[model samples]
Target: MKYFLAFLIFSQTLLASDDWGQNGHRTVGETAENYLKSRVSKKIDRILNGQSIADASTYADEIKSDRAYDEYKPWHYANIPFDQTYAEAEKNPKGDIVFGIEECISKLKSNKLNKEQEQFYLKMLIHLVGDMHQPLHFGLKEDKGANDFKVKWFYNPTNLHSVWDTKMIESYNMSYTELSASLPELSKSEVQSIKSGTLLDWVEESRALTQEVYNSAEADENLSYRYMYDWFNVAQLQMKKAGIRLAVILNDIYS
Candidate 1:
């Protein structure tokens, strides 16, 4: 039984194209729902067959275990070199988070997809919006989004991508609801400010932050309290911004 549980855990991590892990994705989805128009929220409920946005947010990641879903593996991230901007970065022909998000938006807005396709793309959009906010989603191809950039959390061996994706969030011991509520309370103007950007602008913002994330640790360094202190607020802010921007896109689509 113990080995079975361990295998289950390992299989999940291995299969998941995780960004911000499940909790962070759910927090972004839950926060967005708070700001959604009533009509939009009802529409989302119908589209999802009553699943909450928070539950829907992890659908893309959850699907990764299915071999049939293998094509979306690249949609989780966009790799670029440290010194180059996204424009100068070599594009992934398979698609990246930016492409995934844009494609989702375009499909949903066309008003032509069947109900099943609509549900699939909406879930993909929610997940990709959360993914693009995670700085490592724009990380260097050299380290596979820092998964090869090995580091230790406290004393346990892990990779840099795991640190941002789950370590800091899991260490904080918050439920998605708790995490969403703990995020800074924005005024109406602040919420609007977060939603102002186009997809290009948002993608660029996360790409720029990737440099700082790379700078934050050396290979095999032990990351603990100090690491969290330096980066937690930035993580929180990015999730919050993604939530608002997601709400803006959805309201525009279904309004």
Candidate 2:
């Protein structure tokens, strides 16, 4: 019975963020929908099977997989500042966050990378883009995100990072197309500029936000319901931004 109980707990943790509908998660679907409507480059269309970039919204199913959840943890921690205090992650790429994106992008482009390697790296890329937008993924020493925080989300036991990454986003109950339509307007030039930076820059932006988006509640206490509500809005904004930003980058790469 004890063994079964432990197994149940682990399974719940694994399944908790499957839909990303929880508070503080992103709005990736909404941004991707908006992306499909915009005129995308011909090269990106070919890579996306002759469909425009917007048509690729269906591909989001590929992004949200159990494999991605499992793969994210080790790589996420690889970027945490080990030798220095939490402050170090704020200033440099030495943390796994920046290096992970650069390394994956490098491998994605390398002639030496095999099919399996490419697939692994690509999935990591997709997931990491979402992860970077999760402010807690840019976490400090207190929790590594998973350990220190505690919560009862929609009546289930959970943690902060998991909530933002999968639960909150998945809760929108819209297809990527429907969700994408709801994003705020962006100018072409603004979209192009956001897409121009290296993937490392995106990770750095998340890291920088970690410091500015301060939370004062202690780790052991449940995060205030109000705080989660506000954070969810911020997360949706970030996710939409990320999806559009991702489409822009994808358009340029294949263009």
- lDDT leader: 1
* Global CA lDDT computed for model 2: 0.53
> CA shift at 48, candidate 2, in angstroms?
7.7
Estimate the TM-score of every prediction: 0.94, 0.62
Identify the candidate with maximal TM-score. 1
Worst 10 residues of 1 by lDDT: 9-18
Off by over 4 Å in 1: 1-10, 13-17
lDDT of 1 by residue, 1-255 (tens): 999899877877655536898889999999999879999999999999999999999889888878999898898889988777777778889988878888999999999999999999999999999998999988888788899999999999999898999989999999999999999888888887788878888888888888899999999999999999999999999999989888988999999
Residue 26: error of model 1 in Å?
0.4
Assess the local accuracy of residue 186 in candidate 2 as a C-alpha lDDT between 0 and 100: 70
- Candidate 1: pairs in clash: none
lDDT of 2 by residue, 1-255 (tens): 999888766665454343243222224533543454344444334334454333333232333334654444444433344344334545443445455666767776665766556555654554455556666666666666543466645657766655665555555455545555555567888777666776656666666665544353434445446656666567656776677666655444333
